[model samples]
Structures are given as structure tokens and as C-alpha cells.
Target: MLSQFKTPLLLLSSLALCACSAVTQLSSTQSDATITIKEGKHSGNPRSETLKTTSFGNYEFKVEQPQGKVLYGVLPLKFNGGYLAADILFFAPAAFFNLREVYPYYEFDTEKGVVRYKNKPQDSWLEYAPLAAESERAKAYFNAKP
Candidate 1:
């Protein structure tokens, strides 16, 4: 009886893996990247808000203070060839969902006094450039009042 269900379960698991679009940029051997407050009163502390990566290669984070002020940012991600190759070889359809695998690096801009996210891909700096805090969602979050 147990064996009767085993094959179906295995098939389902494989299908789910094949459907998984966003392969985490952090490799199985590495730890998940963390986001911390770069400056301000909370500087150097781990941010309590949640950070999530989209299937299209974007990092989104939001922090809301007790006073109702919201601070948020979205960092664009760059494609990783190594992961792309692995995904193609293992999960073909999932490989086409997204090519981006990591967020390279991020820094606190002393001049701008804001955190800047970056990625240095070969030849093209467009995907590697820093992202600004002008996104509509971020704007709304900041403008929202309690």
C-alpha cells in the first residue's frame, strides 16, 4: 500500500521543482544574505522588517516605525550565468523564469546618506548601477501617516 503512493509523490515533487521559478541567489552552500540598517538611529542593527526577492530579480524591503513613517527600498538583481546553466541542465522551465541569482553587493552612500545596492555584471553596468528610493510603492509607504 505504501509503495502505491510513492511513485505519485516522487512525480509531484519533481513537477514542483520544475515549476519553481526563482532559484535563491544564495547557493545551497551559502547562507541567506541579510539586510541591516546602514545609518540613522538604528544603524548597525539587524532590520526587523522582512526582505523578499521577486521572481524577476528584485529585492524588496519595508520598515515601519511606531510613529508610522515607513522606509523602504528595492534593489535590482543581476543574472548569474552559473546558476542559469545549472537551472537549464536540471530544471529547464524554471531556468526560463529568471536568470538572476544574486544581488552582488550593497553599500551605504556617505554622500547621499542612503543605502545603495549594486551588482557588477560583465560589460553592462546598467544592471549593476545603484537603485534610488523613488519607486512608487516606496513613496507611498513613506507618505503614509498613521
Candidate 2:
């Protein structure tokens, strides 16, 4: 009976370990798409660039910095919350975004240069960037037009 009990215990422990590993992989696997701008042509370096990646891909604008040399910027589209949260954070720069009324995007500090946008971050996996946000642009454009 004791040997039988030991075998069962070992099997149970193995299952528990597998479950824990699966959960760890699930959380760790979650990653967002990065949007970066290529200046001249270097390749790789420190300071990772970023950009919000939502279900609805709507990033397609060149942000013109008000001051400074005008380096690129990116927003970490993937975070605790995507799209909605990312948008609220990404396009926080309503100044330049104001002009791109159709998209209504943002720009936050990141490791690499800046990432520009012209639409709100969406939460749809199918939707992609290079797309236009003409509808949203008409609405929010005037609210904070640049």
C-alpha cells in the first residue's frame, strides 16, 4: 500500500508542475507588435524602439516634433491593457494628432526613437496598420485639431 501511495503522489506532483509551467508560458508569451521609424540606416542598437499594436492597426503618420532635432519615437502598444489603454497613452500628444483628425493617435517615450500615428489604438487582432481612420478622424479631429 505504501508503494502504491508513493507512485500516485509522484504522478500528482508531475501534473502540478506541468500546469504551473503552462501558465508561466501563457503569460510570458503575450507580446505586442512594435512600430519603429528608420532614420538613415544603422541596423541594431541599445534602447529598443516601440509603437502600440492593437486589434485595429491604424498607425501611419509621421509626427513632426515641435522642437529639438526630431528623432523618432514609439509607444509600447502591448501592456497590462492594450488598444484602449495604449491609445490613451500613445496619442497622449494631442497637439500633432489634432491635425490628423481621421486617425487620432498618440506618442509616448520609448527606448528607441518616436513612433507616430493617425488613429486610435484598436483591440482587434484582424485589423492592421497602413489603414485609415477617416471616420474617427472626422469626429475627434476638431476636438483637438492641430
Candidate number achieving the greatest TM-score relative to the actual structure: 1
| TM-score of each candidate structure, all chains considered together | 0.40, 0.19
lDDT of 2 by residue, 28-136 (tens): 0112222223221111221223332234333222322234322222222322232234336544332222221122333322223333332324632222222134324
Give the Cα lDDT of each candidate. Answer: 0.41, 0.29
- What are the runs in model 2 whose C-alpha is more than 4 Å off? 23-146
In candidate 1, the residue pairs with backbone N, CA or C atoms under 3 Å apart (3 or more residues apart, or in different chains) clash, namely 25-101
Distance from true position, residue 65, model 1, in Å?
Answer: 8.7
Error of 2 at 103 (Å): 31
Where model 1 places Cα greater than 4 Å from the true spot, the runs are: 1-54, 62-71, 96-98, 109-114, 117-134, 141-146
For model 1 the TM-score comes to 0.40
